[model samples]
Target: MASRFTRLTTVVPQLARGYAAPAKTVKVPVTLFGLNGRYATALYSAAARQNALDAVEKDLKALDALVVKDKGVQAFLENPTINRKVKLDGINALLSKAGKPSEVTKNLFETLSENGRLDQTTKVISSFAELMSAHRNELSLVITSTKELDKATLNKIAESLQKSGLSEGKKLLVSNKVKADILGGLLVEIGDKSIDLTVSTRLAKLNKLVTDSI
Candidate 1:
């Protein structure tokens, strides 16, 4: 299933593969919804068709890593006063560190930087990754807890969730976050569905139930 999903981006001729009868056809890029998603999706589709998805993915990952490593790169990408050429060179240099970036990747970055949307680069990468994961029928879950959970606890939660029907036949990806304001317990986000077990939410519900019972 996973292998077939990864191959979703691959175009195998139906007739050649004996999967379908021969017919005239046209090619269209797969697009993601949302603005940043659209751009990222277009870039991914282009790279996939050109067989440069791996290279582009690596370049994006490297850039994303830099944004988290050196504070300067993040600030620079988001700073509008730096000028397009400067931002392009900055990203280009980073890409160089990872070896040559695909021309399509370079062009997309340049376009976004020139339009003062470089800040969206991180989101674009994230969106692209998510798009790919989704192509593989994978969904990521963000778990917000008041305190950081140890590996044992996290794996426990993941294990339990895995047994549940939250994703059915689909894949489940988990991300953990710490938020002091939650007071206690955890909140989980699985796609658009969120399960709030935080004390804050429980209290609110209890309060509502009490008031309504009054």
Candidate 2:
């Protein structure tokens, strides 16, 4: 019996070889949704089968960097008016210039092109990175504050998180986001849970308290 992925492979001739079977044991521990997640999961399966997970990750990081740094390439991928062939060629040239493009990566690019889904390039790449982070059993710690956090303060917060049992034993991948609307203090999100310590939240609470007392 052909597995669902096997049937899917057949839909794209070039991808069948890459997505056939994982050469090594690779476990995807997380579930994702939506279009980007769907594509990223499929690519993860294909890369795992080829035992090229790291290569694919490296390719994605490089590609993502290109998308961020190069306006022309970024615009090209986002432009729906451009035909599939042109986008396909452009991606190939960009990868070639970067270095030798891995077979699985190239196959993914071609599949996206053929499906006229090049517009999903950025989201897919980001979603794949998220998968990689999950595979490493890491927690995403987003620290939002009214001002940029200094390294020392960030380190202290990370150390506290490490001991606070909030990370649930997984490694913490900490990042800072500045949101002036928070007014003051910090807003921390660890995975699905969040802590609102910002002045805005406190003010709202205070207002509610006063209103209830009236």
Residue-pair clash count for candidate 2: 1
lDDT per residue as tens, model 1, 6-124: 22223222101222334333233334667666666666656655556777788888888988899888888888687867888888999898788777677667656645677777888
Model 2, 31-145: lDDT tens per residue? 8888677778778877777768899998888888888888888888889899989999989887886799789899888878867778889998989899999888999999999
> Candidate 1 versus the native: TM-score?
0.76
lDDT of each: 0.71, 0.81
- Point out where model 1 deviates above 4 Å: 1-31, 113-116, 210-214
Candidate 2 — which residues are off by over 4 angstroms?
Answer: 1-26, 211-214
TM-score of each model, paired residue for residue: 0.76, 0.87
* True-structure RMSD for candidate 2: 3.6
> Deviation in angstroms for 5 in model 2?
10
Model 1: clashing residue pairs?
none
lDDT of 1: 0.71
Q: Given candidate 2, what's the lDDT at residue 132?
A: 92
